[model samples]
Target chain A: MIDLFLFGIFPYIALVILIGGSIWRYATKQFTFSSLSSQFLEGRLLFWGSVPWHYGIIVILIGHLIGIFIPSGVMAFNRIPLRLYILEGTALALGLLLMVGLVLLLVRRSTSPRIRRVTSTMDIVLLVALLLQVLSGIGTAVFYRWGSAWFPQTATPYLWSLATFSPKVEYVTSLPLLMQVHTANSFVLLAIFPFTRMVHMLSIPISYLWRPSQIVVWYRRQAR
Target chain B: MDVRAQVATVFHLDKCIGCHTCSIACKNLWTSREGAEYMWLNNVETKPGTGYPTQWEDQTKYQGGWEVKGKSLKLRLGRRLGVLSNLFFNPNLPIMDDYYEPWTYTYEHLFNAPPSSEQPTARPISKVTGKFMDIEAGPNWDDDLGGSPVYARNDPNLADLSDAERAALFRLEQLVFFYIPRICNHCLNPGCLAACPSAAIYKRAEDGIVLVNQDKCRGWRFCVSGCPYKKVYYNWMAGKSEKCILCYPRMETGQAPACFHSCVGRIRYLGVLLYDAERIEEVAKSPETEMVAAQRSLILDPKDPTVIAAARMNGINDEWIGAAKKSPVYRFVKEWALALPLHAEFRTLPTLFYVPPLLPIAASSKRGKYDLTDGEFFSSLEDSRIPIRYMARLFSCGNEEIIKTAIKKLWAVRTYMRAASVGDISDQRATSAMSELGCTPEEAREIARLTSLPRWSDRFVIPPYQREDVIQQLTSPIGHKAQVGFGSNVPVRRGP
Candidate 1:
């Protein structure tokens, strides 16, 4: 019953909150949408913490996304022992890098009095949750030994079931405690995403690459 | 010709008395918020002293404005991709220490203190930390060259001066400094507009006032570092960058900006300047020595039939054209050529101009008696306490001749006025001084009148914003009337 509720109904609840809350927040209080950067208050440690954290987490999330989208491709690549080792090794290094970056960020938040003054409750919650998620992910990779191989078989099917509006608890029911924690905590992150600075991830500003450097806004149309 | 009407300014530095009434008025009207205590939208700083952000003119440390590479221009901060990569952590952004930590006295301590032998004191507290703190510095800490040895000695403009000249600047008998009031330049090529990753900062097409869209700004902070003058400020509480909006709401109603309205010395002149937008980049790319002249050439003469026709074709109304005809800025910047843009080498093509100050004549003591006459009448300019080279560095981008001409013209006006009113100097001597700069007696009288005795209307020739026409095009004017007002409808707050 717990597995059915945790793995089946809870994902839908998290998704509803994630989508609805983000839209509502965006429509009602659009001004609140920002990274709320504390770099101006304290930049040196922020440079050390923020840069690595973004780079490492972005790559790791992309890897996870790829596993969900093309499980067959991941399985095909994992067929060779050498290729599997290389893939697993790279993932482990990146996960470690993410961990190191998160630790530095946590230290910066706690030690710097200036940053601490501006640190909100949601900021602390998000940072702690991210640290736990990364730790459990590293834990699952270490003990289970071949997450790249097993993730496609188990988590992807379960995620697809959630997406397709069908419950599939058996796929992830028997997973190890660390893997289960990793999966559950990700949903927690999604549920709380709208209320945190993490929403800045959605605002990547890739359009700036093509947009003209100079922007002139006109209240009235000008004749060319 | 891509003609655009810009409401520009000319600040006569000689008339400024270093009063901060403009700063106070601006603060009370706009930036008395929690996050904006440190921000002074308009600040007057004594020259030969480091400015508010402490050596903001030194671009090497801040990496602001733009740089010329071959024929094209790029942000001195970096390219677009570089800005994206550094979005998470901007290395060039100034810390609070650089701009001085804003603070307020604990006024409640006076009322709430327990009975004591000594008088109760309202100790200083940090606005950011909300704790008792030692006050070290402020926005105008170096006002009137207060810390001359430390702040004035470290001025970036003093880089080219010799040791003797530098020493002479600080000597007791030769001390000289002038006040320079600064606001956003609203440049033809604004570096802040170019550096924004979110495309949040923009210049208004009608009036050329640069503004940051609060809803779109995501606190990347590149705008703060990108502006060469360091005018853009990051509101830590709002998580958005803010700058001088040139008081658009007030301007739309045809009133002068608060700073211009409240200027105690009446040194500020506000008027519409019609300029060709097509040549902004070409003029910004001019060599350092030729930058002042290049920028002057950018301003289209409002009286020119071709320019008026182009402006009409471009949809600039008749009122703005008429205002441009009577523009004091046009006379100061183009006709008289007395005012020049500050730091023209920054290459943003700043629209704000300054008529550089003429310092007190350098006098000598002859055996305990004063000898005020230092040879020829205008030759006193050569021996003035403040060197022309320093003023050139501040205004003309290392071109001494531009500063000399401006000072000579101003000296002629002063001489002409003294002959007419005080009768201390002969009219023949004053006319000779005026003739050197090719100034007629009538022109000198006009210059003297405009500089010292002009009325408010003559000082600020504000063009009608015609906001109703703009509102009609965007939405129903009736619907816009319900929403049109000063201050934001939405509360500006920081995100989690």
Candidate 2:
């Protein structure tokens, strides 16, 4: 019953809240969508925190997506013992980098009085949740070992089943406790995503590269 | 010609008394919100002192406005790719210390304190953190040369002065300063507009007012670092950048902006200026020495039939063209050529102009009588307490000749007026002085009247915005009737 609810029911609930909540917020309260940067008040520490955190988390998220999309490719790449070690080593290093960056950011939020004043209760909750997720991820990599080699075989199928609207409990149910926590916390993050500053991730501003340098808006007939 | 009409301004610096009525009026109307406590949309600063953001004119540090390379103009902040990388961590963005941490007094202590032997006092607390703090600096920390040794002495404009000239400026007898009131220049090539990654900042085609779309602004803060004048301020609570909107809501209703309307000294002048939009980039890329002249040529003559026809073709309408013809800004900027744009070298083609102050002459008391050291009826231009070189740096990008000509014309007007009313100086001397600058007695009289005795209507020639016609083009008038007022119905809070 627990496995059925966790894998089948909770994922849909989290997805509904993430998608529905984001669209609702964007429609009714669009102005609230922002990174809510505290760099103006305290920049020196933010530079140390924000840069590494973004770079590390982005790469890790892309890695997870790759495992889901091309599980066969990852399995082929990890066939050789040397290749598997390299892949696992790189993932561990990146996960550690993410941890270090998140810890610095947390310290900055707590220690700086100016930053603390702007820090919301939701922000604290999100940060703590993220720290726990990263810790569980790192623990899975250490204890379970060969996550890159096995992720495709077990987690990928489970995720694909979930995406296709079919609940598949057998694949993830047998995974270690840390691996389960990692998967469950990711859904938790998704559920709370719309309510936090993390929505700024959707606003990447890539279009700025191609847009005209100057923008002149016309209220009446256009100027010649 | 792609002609467009811009409502421009001119500040006659000679008439400014350094009173901060404009700043106060702007504060009361627009920026009296929680996140905007530190912002002063209009501020008057002593010229030889660091401005509100402390050394804003020092472009080397701030990296604002534009840099001309060969024939192309680019934002000093960096290219598009550079801005993208720095989007997360903007190196040039001014910290709170740069503009001073805003503070308010704990006034409740004064009212609620129990009876004490010592006088009850209100200690200052930070507006951002809400913690007790020692008040160190403010928006106008160096107003009227307050803390002159620290702020005034370090002025970026004084960088090129000779050692002797610099020393003479600070001497007790030679000490001089003038007020320079500043608002956003609403530049033709606005750096703030160019640097916005989200395309949130834009210039209005109807009138050249630059505005930030509150709904689109993602708060990357490039606009803050992009404006050379440091006019754009980041509202921490709203997580968006805000600037002087030029009181457009009021202007649309045919009232002057709050700052312009409340100017205590009557130094502010407003009017429409028709310009060729196609040449903005070309004008902005002019060489440093020719920047002022290039900007002047950019403002098309409204009285010219060709320009008028072009303006009409561009949908500027007859009312704006008529207002442009009678614009005080045109008279001050192009006709008499007495006014000059502030920091034209910034290459923004600032619409605002300043009639440089004819500062008090350096005179000495000899035998209990004030004696002009130069021994001329109008003291020699070189004898003016504030060096012409300094004014050149401020106005004409180190073009001393331009500053000298404007000052000479201003002095000629003063001499011409004194001869007519006071009769202390001979008419022959005044006429000769006026003729030296090719200024006739009639023109001098007109200048003096407009300078000193302008009525409310004469000072502010607000063009008919015809907002109804403009709005009708985008949406049905009946449909738009419900949302006609200023600001969003929902209060702009930080997060969902």
lDDT of 2 at B382: 74
lDDT of 2 by residue, B91-182 (tens): 99998889889898999999999998989999999999999998889989998788899999999999899989989888875678999999
List each candidate's DockQ score: 0.69, 0.64
For every model in order, the fraction of real contacts preserved is 0.77, 0.70
Off by over 4 Å in 1: A221-224, B365-379, B472-488
Per-residue accuracy of model 1 over B1-496 as CA lDDT, tens digit each: 8999999999998889999999998888778877888999899898889998999999999999998988889899988999888888888998899998888899998999999999999999999988889988889888888988889999999999999999988987667888999999998899998999899899988889999888788888899889999999998887888899787777777778899999989999999999999999999898999999999999999999999999998889999999999999999999999999999898898889999888767666778877766675545666878888898999999999988899899998998888899888898989998998999988888888899999999999999877666742232222322221123355556788
Candidate 2 Cα errors over 4 Å, as ranges: A221-224, B365-374, B472-487
Candidate 2: chain B TM-score equals: 0.95
Candidate 2: docking tier? medium
Deviation from native of the Cα of residue B113 in model 1, angstroms? 1.8
- Of candidate 2 chain A, the 10-residue stretch with the lowest lDDT total is A215-224
lDDT of 2 by residue, A15-77 (tens): 999999999888887787777888889998899888888888989989999999999999999
